[model samples]
Target chain A: MSQDSQPRKNSRFHLTVFALIAMLTAVLSVGTPAPAQAEDGTFKLGLVTFLSGGAAGPFGVPARNAAELVIEAINKGTLPAPYNSIGIAGQAIEPIIIDEAGGGTKQVGEYRNLIQRKNVDAVIGYISSGDCMAIAPVVEELETLTVFFDCGTPRIFEDNKYKYLFRTGPTSTMDNVAAARYVLDINPDLKSVSGINQNYSFGKDSWADFKGSIQTLKPSVEFKTEQFPKIYAGQYGAEVSSLMLEKAEVIHSSFWGGDMEGLVLQGAARGLFDDFTGVFTCGETGMFRLADQIAEGTILGARGPFGVYAPKSPLNDWLRKNFMARYGTPPTYPAYKMAQALMGLKAAADKAAATAGKKPTQDEIIAAFTGLEFEGPGGTVKMALGNGHQAVQDMYYGQYSNKNGKPTMTNVKRYPADCVNPPDGVTSTEWIKNGLKQASCK
Target chain B: MLKTDNTSRNLCIAFVLLLLVGLILPNWLAFLTTIALAKAMVVVGLVMLMRAGLVSFGQGLYYCLGGYTVGIAGQHLGITDAVGILFVSAFIAGCLAALLGLLLCRYREIFFAMLTLAFSMILYGVLVKTSELGSTDGFNVAKVTLLGWQPSPGQLSLVVYSLACLVAFLTAFFMHRYYQSGMGFAGEAVRENEIRVEYLGVSPQRVVFIKYVLAAMLAAVGGSITAMIAGHVDPEMAYWTTSGEFVFVALLGGTGHVVAAFIGAFLFEVIRTIAFDLAPYTWQMILGTTLLLVIFFLPKGLWSLLKAKKVGGNNV
Candidate 1:
């Protein structure tokens, strides 16, 4: 080898790496330009959801799956109402997808790249409540329309009233309040209530909101011994031992994914559920992943604006089978919620194209989406412009029961969006200052 | 400057050109490069420790400690000045290390590593249980108080990047000086032969412990810088895995030279991005393979490999 030729080789390598980087940057820049090109059929709907990682995306994964199934079903002309033969205006809605399965600063940048550079018409994403709370402001500034599926952090919507943002799933306030009401419904005289939850905003807020509702609803039930465990981390043996020792009649937890599954398995192993009634705030996976170890008699609450296994409706069944067929799993509510976000965009586009007599503008889509409630497999769901771009939707509670050796929500009941959620006119900042609002679903 | 490998120094100049490419590279690259710089800070400190006969698995403890202190001090104590916070963080780690070093100074070899690890685990346990501090969820920092003027309103990215350059410059400056000092000589000697170092009238335990404290302080500065840039810090920063990452970066850079840390940092940032794009799900596999290859073939680190090629030798 000629040593004199080496500088040229290094230069060539560096040049190639530079050129490749240049090409990538050019591709990335023009790739997903928001509002740059409004060409019909060219518009991409970026549906970001967690397809991997921790139990962070249990609801979001299902929501994304359901969204995919709905898109598939709608593409096939198999959905109900204005959804049949649903081609948005004259242009068909196309999905450009990315997975935001993990949360952190890195993942947020990834979302920005998808929304800003991928040139998505909308973003329906995020399962982790913390990530959603962090990203809300950025998306608001960018105005890349996003419809969140199952990030239940109340702080997300309480602050900004972001124009381009909308939430479809229930809030943490709704989920916990509904859980408390459901428990009291079963036994009115239930006394001591203990909560063991993941120590993030969702878990802590679940206990706080549930306690607030319980204080107002079942005046006699004293909430005590609240346990906050780090989410998706460590064995819950010590936390569970403390709870078991408490002998509280009603135990509520917001642990989900592996943490939920692990705790339930351990509690069952330890006979922690021998006589006590237990409620899980997010036990809504339809037994796809967590069914094996979830102790019997424990009720799970869902942010179920899209009903979880609502009826034998052919479309729901088709969606279920379709998702199972495609993904080797039954459709969870998150999948449907994700589908709703997409369908909502396509529906808006179609409506705008009809009313404007042309392709939908950003304003037209915005107008169409405002107070625009559409009926789907799980009844009508609407998004009113709430504070910080939060969804005002129903949260449901159900007892997990075996249906043919599968976990399904039984005794489900709806707690409306405005119930326990901040008032319709309230802003996120004010809600934070006022703490959470308390209301009965009735 | 005198201790640095020339080829790596040129690669840095080349990276400066690559950074120019970033001007046109889009926000994604800028975002990623920022993270790499942040991680590199901690990695540099690890290299320093490794040179001194110390392999710290508790660097994360200092990182988390520095990060949380900056966040809390900025948000609560009104210490919004970014430079001041860094100083405060470094000072805090220095003090904590000095106190802990007194006890740790008498310990030898594996016991020192374990004791530092124990300190980190204690921090993790305490932080996890303390919900008001956001504990395991971590404190979401809104802004770094830059003196009385906070920089979040305008030029958030630029302000952070500027502070980053200053920190990098400072880290390189101080760490370079550290490696050239009599302490540096003792550290190398201590790593090579502790009994000999003991015979030379410097207790190996004391040298290693002092090195441990200094490394902890450096790691703390890095952590504070990252927390300010990212706007979040959690107990995860204190996890042993975080410590392990620094060690990996040191190994990747060959740990023999100060500039290798910078080279390792750049490669890590670039490769990690490439990995994320290519496999998104299985990036760890690529990371593992790269590490194995670097460890097995280029035992002197990437810089040493480049230097060997300059000799016109056949061996790679």
Candidate 2:
């Protein structure tokens, strides 16, 4: 075993060479903006996120609201700095919105259009992980400066090839890890657990992370059943039947959007939560959308960058008030995430504005975004200059409680950003350095 | 009347237009349009079965199975070629579908649809429980190996899908070929009155079962083609709604021709895009309105509308 280990350590030479190349390139492009074009002049901004479909009515609408508020605030000159002056050359920004529908190549096609045809200055927003992951290739290939606000998957950070893509939300791993910590902390006496996630990447990723973390934190937990239902499959009657049969001490569910509401409503009706200590990780985000359906005792985890009222950050508080005032209802975490991401990209804009030699180029703006840290409503969130390219962000966990006749998570716990570290072999920024090579026009 | 069954032959026209779009349009539109085209492939296949006296709400299961097969084979088996992935996925789903079809074909009408749906759910259940395939966590599919060819750019994926649409058309072409032939008439006779086909000494059960298996393999091909293009796959591809979408696209096209599947699927995706973009909250209204309009006016389906050329002085 020791001899095998010795050979493997040396075989990591390939990874080391790649890392060194990345480091050198990161050093060489120290001052050069990525595109070096004047995007400050009149230009289009593409907003790609889920705005309809099963998940849209719930989680996506909130994300849409955030983008709208950001655009409106930016256009009206009301969006506070570091985003106040986020425009190219001397032109005002025009936000063109596109809704990513279904998990097929449709979203990627729209994104390719957004960058190549529309000539959008930058891209922001993704509510669904499937869309986010699918678009990752497009954005990398196109070399567009894109910021992902809500679609959080560890895969995005684990791969170093995408230099232009940046996501501010917690990864799938982070959400799972946070929820596990939240559930185990509350029910430390728990020994047996089961998982029920939507049958897709988001569900499987979260479920795997939760189980892995649960084992890491507490070694004695026995896993019972892992049930995955088809996404947007209106009924969960049979999957629920299996979960009930498991009779585990805790039920860990990663279902979201309409599927989440459908399962929760159905599970509640079947009394699945009656005896089981439920860990409904994705419940908090869609609580407002689902309203009364989520049961009180269920633990709701947030892909949140700190909640509005919980453990105050000045930026977070101010943004909360602005969002509520602008949108007329308290914004959900997705809204905040989209808003924060655009605001962060505006940091790139500001950096471009600051060093234009009279005006900044797209390259300068892109350069400013890399390794740049900005104070926003979510406190000072920093982009990962590391190869995985994900910035430092935290997640919040709250227990669901009856607040003003609706289900909301309380007893929230805050974890540090570094708590959920990404796997090695990932670093800052992956983009399509060879955009013209791909012939996006086909 | 069945001359319209030459969908593959007719697809040549759309393929030409697609080439034009590929060269002239901005990539974003081309890319989105390509996806819409790819989706149209399955919608075409599903519409064929629906017209033949079956409506499956289990298309998503097969779709998901095809996707997962490609995903699992590529990730686990280290096969990355798009063509290889599609072959592996289609073969796996086709074999399983044939097995499942054997059991499901015994039932008639809703029973058949329900049984297929139940089987799809079983696959969905398996995908979720088995963490080795990442369960609900989707796996990232790298470049698709298409018969030793790789589609790297989103455009390449689009082009590959365009070819897949061709493949789907050819399958439908053959299905139409079968439909126009003696066996198709026999199947129709069975559809009209199964007791007569049974009385004729040719077992209706075997014919329908074989037809079911054949139709499933076609859908599996469509699904595999899509997974290769999407670069990721989830079990949701096999969900009930996924299956229902096939019925929706088929019916929307109204089985006027196999080509209607392409048109219906394309229109569904395009209308969906419009609906979501314009009213997002009420995009279903577009779907409802289109369904209402088509059912009311173009009762034969969308092909008739496209075929309705204004003849003024012949070619004025």
Candidate 3:
């Protein structure tokens, strides 16, 4: 090559490389905010939920929809009763929605991004128990006020104490306790009970809690079989056969999301539900999608008094009406949990502002949230456990029945929070084993 | 003399550029880059295996082992020092690879791939059932310390980022040299014709076993750093999809150059973040389309673009 040509080519290559670097730097700068600017009086909130993947269908999508509708209602000052205000403490709510489909580690990084890069004043969302556990410490380390909406693992608070993190819904133990109670209350001749749960923390803990509660409630109720299938295992042929072989009079499952739907479909196809009265702890989330497949007389629990079992009140009526009108279906348990979390945040923020005469800081908001009581769609949610870091709420369970070709719960029984939830300082296992003597059921 | 001088100068230039990035980039970008670079270490290991005509569909087994080692060491064993945890994790991963390599080197192609995948799935199953380690909920990794000095939360990110840069540069430098070594060439020879390598008085299986062990160590480093940065570890690290991602990045960057893995991981992260932001509902579709386009236009991978330009070729 000629010398002059070589120099010209080198210059062109240098220009191209420089341009590429400049372009990448510019693109990256888009995700990074330009430092913390003066607050514009808007309450920036980061709302995370699964937007894609298996969990999104039953849990994440409904939660996202509820956040959208509720935020819009709050900003417009159209919510009924205590929530009838323009945003929290008169500040407009600006939400930045993030997908939580990624694993726990990714969720931790996203949580940091929400606080450090996006400058969200408060953050709420996590349906995966793993994500909640992973994020709890990081939230405390970052000193960011955060609320875990629907992850049911009790270990988040049981294992570690967090100053700025709270779960706005009851733990998984409550659902299991109420499920066992409902079964024993109705089935006087109940003898053998079998269980099929996803082989995960939530499922294992729930099964253990249910078995402990049942063993305490009836000593002669023989345990037949227990199967822990992998989470999101799309088929249940073998699991169904095992349940049939065991001849369990009642089968208990804490499956949720697509896994629950898959089990219902496959079990019904095999006539597994015919001989066994299946009791599902998280059946409400999939009821709308699996209406036809859910056999009549199959018991269902909402994890709380949510969806069809929601209390009769104007606030709940408005939530149900607005959510149904927008999403073309009534809000389910996941949506109710999301709504409850946001409503609790609103109450805390409003009270803190009123007390301080200004928008409260993260610590101030957390202080107000501790022992905070608010009326949720499901009824009253009290931060009555975990040193007020955890919520204890009443739960409902009922049998599924087809009413006018749509699935609805019949003979629903609402168990008081004090009846199901373990008392302060007592683990669910210990409480159940001790026959719940310390529990206040009134 | 000139070739050695050029290598030194390039290394200096790259180090300076990374230092500048660490200084200038925002915290979130720095965090993302650190993670991508850490993950690139594993992709580089995959590329090494690919050079030997071996594809591990279960590299996550080593990766997850590394992460869980760091976690369990810190949480249960009271080993909170970053360097100590990383060392223990790498040692554990290397030992496992050494034992597994004996049997694994006996197979090739699909059998090797399936065996690796099966191993990772076994780890996943074990982790899912082990409730003491938080079961599927997984456990949080405690804050890391350097020697006896513990950085506060604000300073932790910067410290981790700097460490990631230093580790990545050193690994890449050694890897570049290893590519031209006798054992490295023997790997390619075994890949091309195992009988010919055996006839050359070099045991092909031995070379493969050494490469497998080395890859496991590199992947462990990647996993350890990732756990430190994220401050959490779960069975998902050992899931088949995570290993698939490593393979994707390795192929995306090509096994031609050592630096390609870093570039590929960086580009992947940037593309994925932007896609998720722009189309949260269809980000996976966008990612798939990008991969398809890359395969259609630049089948040799993204690194081939730089190589083709350097050679002034019309390969595209």
Q: Number of clashing residue pairs in every model?
A: 24, 50, 0
User: TM-score (0 to 1) for chain A, all models?
Assistant: 0.85, 0.80, 0.93
Best by DockQ: 3
Q: Interface RMSD in Å per candidate, to 1 decimal? A: 4.3, 20.6, 3.4
Which 10 residues in a row give candidate 1 chain A its minimum summed lDDT? A427-436
- For model 3, residues B201-302, the per-residue Cα lDDT tens digits are 999899999999999998998999998988889999999999998988887787888888998898887777666666767888887897887688657677
Worst 10 residues of 3 chain B by lDDT: B307-316
Estimate the lDDT of model 3.
0.86
lDDT of 1 at A382: 65
Compared with the true structure, what per-residue lDDT tens digits does model 2 show for residues A186-236? 888878998888766677767877887777678799999998776788798
TM-score of each: 0.84, 0.77, 0.94
Highest TM-score among the candidates is held by which one? 3
Model 3 residue runs over 4 Å out of place are A1-23, A34-38, A403-407, B1-5, B16-25, B313-316
In DockQ, how does model 2 score against the reference complex?
0.15
The whole-model lDDT of each prediction reads: 0.69, 0.66, 0.86
Put down candidate 1 lDDT per residue, A340-431, tens digits, no spaces. 56666667767777799877788788778777776544455666547323445666677766656966666777666666466777643344
- Which lDDT value does model 2 have at B96? 78
Q: Model 2: what TM-score?
A: 0.77
For candidate 3, lDDT tens digit of each residue in A146-177? 99999988878777777889899899999998
lDDT of 1 at A297: 69
